[model samples]
Target: MKRKSLIITLLILGSILFANGWDVQEYPYDLYVYYIVTKAPEKYENLIGSSVVAVTSHRHGDFGNAFNSSCKSGVIEFLENEDFVIDKMDGIDSTFLSKSFIEKYFPEVLCADISVSKEDLSYIWENLSSKYVGFSDMKKRGLNKKKFNKIKNTSELKALFDKYMEDCHFDMKIREFTYYQETAYDEGCKKSKDQRDIYFEQETSNAYYVRFTSCVEANANYFTNLEAVGVIGRNKEFIILDARSNYGGSNYVQEKLQKILNLEKYKGTVIVLQDNWSTSSGEVWSIFGNEKSQFKTLLVGTHSGGMQNYDRSNTIKNDDLNIEISFGSKYLGKILPKNYLGEGKGYEPDIWATTETMASVLTGLGVDVTGITFQ
Candidate 1:
């Protein structure tokens, strides 16, 4: 009889604990809640309870998993009255709090103020003539800068920008204004590897192929690799520069490549290959080679990635959340051509061909590929 009574009592206690499970509070949960309430109160005031679930269930990155695992689990609970109650404590290390983790799990919270504002429109309008290179072109398309004053949000602003881009056939990938969000892991947790800047292959006696995987100046071999291409391909009748899948880096690297290749003095035809993955500075370099080169140049493959309008980025940090929001600060409008592509629209190729069909395509274009191989 006594054993039965004890079992019943334990069952009641277990039920109570389970019922009050969400009523518990911990430091990490408190910090998360505090950040949401303080930084983005208007956006998250109603969704605080749901955000707690998201934070707890988040398992995509290293920091999230470490902080939320059972080994480091602290009692967490949200109340209807907006009260945080603590029943147990298991502290999480502050080192695990990272900007990448917050960005991945809580993008809305991080970018709450990303919506377009009246001030933003006013500033763009005021600087349109002097700062925006596309100003005259956009106006020629019947897009009045004043119309932007009616934009209520980011979506509306983006729609207006998209319309202008489509009408002008500009690079739709370059935005007149943009918010940049970087979700990469912090430097401490990132893995390092040795990577080559460029790869060269002699396809035939008359033809050579050079693939630029990266144009980052940070790479110690960047200049050396470009110099090697200039030396090796100087005598080739046909030079194929493949920039497919290259993410791009510094503008100076592209400038260095241009100087090294010295296309103005070259006698051979230069074919610059690009795909949708060839983005930022890579796309710029490809476009320059095709449009600005002194020698005959052909841009092959699909459209190049078009995120090249913004030249610089600025960051705003939330110290409490330990998160940084990066935004495009410098617009490239002043220097880019009037017909330059917009954000989201990449550069169109002169010859459309994939890696598999490149050999056939070149042959069709009257280029001899009898002994040449495609990779």
Candidate 2:
């Protein structure tokens, strides 16, 4: 019995020395929680009681099979109060707290997903290093300082992401794909492509309408559809870039569209129609039209969904535990205005109008919008 115990002890020590042991240190959720607390302690200090405290308590302990099981239980307990934790969140282990932040605080403005591979790190690195406007206010929005400090450049960030990928896991929870979400995305794409008025069309001598949806410009259909909007904006007296249902994508859409439309020379009064659905680049375009457009511009609608910043994310999956950790490294807001505070609060519209009353409101502004509809 004594010889057998000695052999087991040596095996455990060897596993630890080789860094191949599945201990508390390797538990993605525990490490992630530790990263958040250590990195953004002040931001999340007050929200302590459940798994936040539990995970943070054992940051340095050896994580074996027993520890992982207990840690998962603790995390689930902490996530019980979060509004969006559907079905006990059995699949999630490390992303509970940040995911809560996404669902509760920045639901419309930001997106993060569980990834089990390192294939997308290069793309993530590119976005993180891009130019942003408001660089100082990142901490207020929960940017992890510890992780940010380690990644000073693109190469460093890539290396850090690679480090997280050392442990491979097949997260059953994350692997449980929801077909409904994909179906919705497909439907939205179809609707945006099929919508005819995204390109500018003359409805009257002084009034023009463009019911635009999405800023995802790679689609050939969108490029083909919106070409006419540029043709009319140069000579039209009034232009309406409708963005009531915009959800956002690349800013290239704005850059390309403005160039194609010759918006700088357009002498018309351009009015942007936005609402809560207008997010990310949608909000950016509205702000651009209102403050930077060469033509006279007016933004009409309710508060716009303000998710103008860019996010850098890392996804870690532990196949042994069947869990995944999707976390953000940085939140770059360089494109936003210097003093912009419209992240969660959204951007207040100059003329507050809902979908029902938008057409009437447009008509009142000397825009003979007889058949124009807002989406």
Candidate number achieving the greatest TM-score relative to the actual structure: 1
Question: Candidate 2 has what TM-score?
Answer: 0.46
Cα lDDT tens digits, model 2, 1-375, are 999999999999986644421112223554243312111123233333212322110001102121222243334333343311111112222222323333333333222243433333333323333422222233345444355554433344434433332111101122322100000111111111123113444466677776656666533444565556666566667777776556555555565656655545777776777765566665644345534555566778766655554432455554653444343344544446544444434566678677767778877888878676543
On residues 1-375, what C-alpha lDDT tens digit does candidate 1 reach at each position?
999999999999998655543332223452333222111123223333322222211111112322322211221312322222111112311112233344544555433333556655665556544544555666777788668788876667666765653211122111222323221121222111112354445566677766665677644455566556666777778777767655666656556555656743778877877765566666654345544556667788766656666643443443443333333445554555444455555676778776667789877766666654454
Deviation (Å) of 133 in candidate 2: 13
Minimal lDDT window, size 10, model 2: 178-187
Residue 295 deviation, candidate 1, in Å? Answer: 0.8
| Model 1 clashing-pair count | 16
What is the model-wide C-alpha lDDT for candidate 2?
Answer: 0.44
Model 2 stretches astray by more than 4 angstroms: 1-202, 217-219, 260-264, 284-287, 290-292, 311-316, 321-332
